[model samples]
Target: MRLIVKIMLLFPVLLYSQSNFEKAEKLFSQEKYALAKPIFENVIKENPNHLKALEYLGDIEGMNKSWDSAMFYYGKLKQLNPKEANYYYKYGGCLGMKAKDCNKFKALGMISDIKSSFEKAIQLNPNHIEARWALIELYLQLPGIVGGSERKAQKYANELLKISPVDGYLAKGHIAEYFERYKDAEKNYTKAIAIGGSKTTYQKLADLYKNKMNQPQRAKLVLETYQDKTKS
Candidate 1:
């Protein structure tokens, strides 16, 4: 009799927890993160090991640019599921954001961990396009004394060619621009634009023409075309 009463009492609590989780998930899917966050927190309180709730909370914090808070949640997820590539990727991204706001000395200290996390993510998922892109940018931006190498950037760009030709050309154009090879950059950027008429590619070409080649007319033309396309 007492056991039956306890079961009846517990059933409503379980139903409430499931209903709350479903509501939180629906809100999260709609990107209503501000509304979803507290519900997820409540779900976590009810079931502390709720993986999806924890993951969504991390994603919500990340979307809000709360890097430290995002890292805390993602770090917990990574500890709980070390083999998940996306967890490491998110953790690396949060670390990168934190580094960006820190002093040079602190940022330098974080660089290795950031690199390792991304690398581990790639190792776990070889076709992770975003991870490859992150590594390419990291290599291109870093100084030689650290881990920056154009050659490494190029290698990743070549790998990107296998995954996405448009991204590969853009990466090559960026590398060429870094080397002050304006003509090569122009050629590659043009090729990228031809392959995929992305607004970003057009913007890059316009910037190159205006800043690097000193061709305001060409830049203006590109921008005008971009505006027309966007309006259409």
Candidate 2:
């Protein structure tokens, strides 16, 4: 009789937990994170295997920049669903964000995790542009074993370039710059500028010639052309 009474008492708590989970899902879809987090937490407390709740709560924590909490939730979710591509990717992104808080001081772990996550995402969906872009940027920024390698960076860049003319120019220019192939860089930069002129491309090329390559005269010529075009 006592056991039956205890079970009956627990029924409303279970119902309430499930109801809160549904409400949380609705709120989360509507971008009401502030309202959804507590309900998700309640659901997790009641039923720890709530995989979607755990994943979304971790994502919310990441979006809020609550790194430690995000890591905690993602870690839990990963244990439950280790093979899920999104779980790995989001976990890597959270680590990347946390690394940024330290201004690259803790970048090694972040880079490793990011690389792993991107690899997993690509395996899951070979055509995922976001993961491909992530890998491209990672290799481009630190092309060596310490972070990445020039050859690998060039490979990814070339792959991305094949998809579109403008992206090709951008990728080739980055690879050229990485290898100190200044002439190639200049040519690709020019092509990129001609196809789609952005102030950033102008600035990058100008700085490269002026500072890295010790060609201030060439940099000045570029600035002059830019001014002329802008005036026109």
The RMSD (Cα, Å) of candidate 1 is 3.0
User: Candidate 1: which pairs clash?
Assistant: none
Q: Write the per-residue lDDT of candidate 1 for residues 150-205, one digit (tens) a residue.
A: 89989888887888888989989999998899999999999998998899899999
lDDT of 2 by residue, 17-105 (tens): 88888999999999999999988988998989899889878989988999889988888877897777777667777776776677554
lDDT of 2: 0.78
Q: Each candidate: what lDDT? A: 0.91, 0.78
Best candidate per TM-score, number? 1
TM-score of each candidate structure, all chains considered together: 0.83, 0.61
- The TM-score obtained by model 1 is 0.83
- Model 1 Cα shift for residue 161 (angstroms): 0.7
Best prediction by lDDT: 1
